[model samples]
Target: MLELRGLGKRYTVHDREVVALADVDLVLKPGSFTVVVGRSGCGKSTLLRLLAGLTLPTTGAIHHNGGRPKVGCVFQEPRLMPWLTVAGNVGFGLVGKVTKAEIEARVEAALALVGLSDFRNAYPDQLSGGMASRVGLARALVLEPELLLLDEPFAALDAFTRRGLQGELTDIWLARRPTVVFVTHDVEEAVLLADEVLHMDGGRIIGRREVPLPRPRDATDREFVALRRAILDDLSGRAGSSPPPA
Candidate 1:
């Protein structure tokens, strides 16, 4: 399990202290999928960055049952090395840490997982936006991390590509149950993918809603519609501290 206790961060900008996160206490069980959703500047990215150890919290602790676990992260953009081929980009994280043959095998598998096997030799410039984003996801998955952190990785994709990748992501999670923490502003995406959806505002997690919906869910399903509506209302200032039960 991974736990955050009183986790907070204060950044100094131009000699003033700005709190990015405040008193965030969370418990994430192994192999669970959770989504953090809120408007921009709500500190969702800050919280994920803290979890990924990209930054340190100013006033709290992060604890895990075992030693530091392997982590993988994907950001809003692909961030691929422009000159590297698809296979090389996927295997970038394993450089010098593993053998050439090992890297080749993992990259091959990851490319296949994300349906990019045929484009192994293509450089970043050759791929479309959606394909490049999948390459980013494959790069992270190649590490086979215990913790996967995604910061709105698909926010830039078109609606069709976004929906397709969402299903693919669900399939990947079911096949390899890593602890996933995804941050996004899309309420529909949150309800569609999260086991638990956390709402944030002004650097704090103010509400949470359990999805408890089955995989390959239907957006038009009554329950799914209701859950999405409740979350939208909550985020739009029409609901209470927590969204009423779905």
Candidate 2:
């Protein structure tokens, strides 16, 4: 499990300190899927960065149940190298730590997992937006991390593509059971994907609501619609009542 104790982050811009995250506390249990939803600049991405140890917090601690866990991340953009093939990008981090054969095996398995085995030899410039995103996901999976972090990984895809990828993500999560934390601004997407949805605003987690509706959820269903409205109201400071625990 991962625990955050009064975790906070701030930055200095032109001599003034700006708070990106403030007094934020959260606990992420193993094998659980949690999604953070908020408007832009609400510190959703910042929280993911802090959890991945890519950045330090200003005034809090992130505690793991045991030793530090292995982390993998897929960012909003696919940060692949222009010179490398899809396979190379997927296995990019394995150099010096594993043999070429091992990297090749892992890369192949990851590509298969993301349904991109046929695109292994293609260059980033040659693939479509969704295909490139798959390459990014494959790269993160190749590391076999215990904790996976995604920052709007599907925000750029077209609606049809986004739905397809979301389904694939759900399938992969159930199979691998990795602790997943996804950050997004889409209310329907958050409610559809996460076991718990957190609302962040003003650099702090303002509310959290558990999504107990059945999996493979339909966005148009009455229960799903109700949850979406409630989350929207909560985020806008109009939810009225405090949400129950997850």
Candidate 3:
């Protein structure tokens, strides 16, 4: 289990203190998936960065059941090396840290998990946006991290590709059972992927909603639509709003 206590972050922007995240208290169970949804600049990215240890928090503390767990992070962009092949990029971080044979085995498995095994030798320029995203995911998964953080990794893809990748991500999460914290602006996407949806506004988590639906959830299902609509309304300060459209 991982626990965050009174978590907060502040930045000195033009000599004025800016609070990006404030007093966030959360507990993440091992193998559970949580999605954070909010409007732009609602501290969603900041929270993920703090979890990834990319930045230090200004207040509070994070506690892990064991010592700090290995963490993997995927950003909005793939950030792949233009000169490296897909396999090379996936194993880039393991160079000199693990044996070459071990790196190859792990990279191969990660690519297979992301369905990108056939593109092992493809360069970044040769792949489409969705494929590049998969490579990014493969890079993170190669570490077999205990905690995974994604910051709108699919936000730039086309709608069709985005939906496909969303399903693929759910499959990966189910198979690996890594504790995941995914941040996004899409309420529907949150509803589709999260075991629990955290609503953030003005740098604070305002609400939490459990999604008890089964896997392979249907977006058109009444319950699914209703939950999505309700989350949207709550985020928009329209709680108890009208029912979802028929």
Candidate 4:
């Protein structure tokens, strides 16, 4: 388990103190999938960065059940090395840390998990946007991290590719059961992927909604549509006195 207590971050912008996150508290269960959703600059990415230990928190503390677990991060862009092949990029982090044979085995497995095994020798420039994204995901998965953080990783893909990758992510999560924190601006995407969706606004988590639906959820299903609409209404301050339609 992981817990955040009164977590906050401040930045000096133009010599002015800016609060990116403030007094935020959260708990993530082992292997649970959580998605954070909010508008641009609402501190969604800041929260993710703090969780990833990319930056130090200005206030509060983070506690892990067993020391800090290994972490993997996938950003908005693939950020692949132009000169390296897909397999090389996936095993880049393991160089000198693990034996060459082990690196090859792990990279091969990661590539298979992301369905990019055939592209093992492909360079960054030779792959399409979606394939490059898969390579990014494969690189993270090769580490077999306990905590995985994604920052709008599919935001730049076309709609069709995005949906496909979302399904692939769900599959990977189910298979590996890594604690995942995914950040996104798309409510439907959040609803589709998250076990619990966290609503953030003005540098704070304002609300949360549980999704108890089964896997392979149908977006057109009444319950699915209602939940999506309810989250939107709540975020927009348009929620009715009555609960979402049954």
Return the top candidate by lDDT: 1
lDDT by residue for model 2 over 114-174, one digit each (tens)?
A: 9999989999999999999999998998999899999999999999989999998998999
lDDT of 4 by residue, 7-117 (tens): 999999899999999999999999999999999989999999999999999999999988998898899999999999999999988889899999999999999998999
Q: Which residue pairs clash in candidate 1? A: none
Kindly state the number of residue pairs that clash in model 2: 0
Residues 1-246 of candidate 1 have per-residue lDDT tens digits of: 999999999999999989999999999999999999999999999999998999999999999988777899999999999989999999999999999999999999999999999999999999999999999999999999999999999999999999999999999999999999999999999999999999999999988889988988999999999989888887887835454444
Error of 1 at 189 (Å): 0.3
Model 3 CA lDDT for position 217:
91
Model 3 stretches astray by more than 4 angstroms? 241-246
lDDT agreement with native, every candidate: 0.93, 0.92, 0.93, 0.93
Number of backbone-clashing residue pairs for each candidate, in the order shown = 0, 0, 0, 0
Find the 10 residues in a row with the least total lDDT in model 4. Answer: 237-246
Backbone clashes in candidate 1 total 0
lDDT of 4 at 78: 98
* lDDT of model 2 at position 75: 94
The positional error of residue 227 in candidate 3, measured at the CA in angstroms, is 0.1
**TM-score of every candidate:** 0.97, 0.97, 0.96, 0.96
Question: In model 2, where is the ten-residue run with the lowest total lDDT?
Answer: 237-246
Q: Which sections of candidate 2 miss by over 4 Å? A: 239-246
TM-score, candidate number 3: 0.96
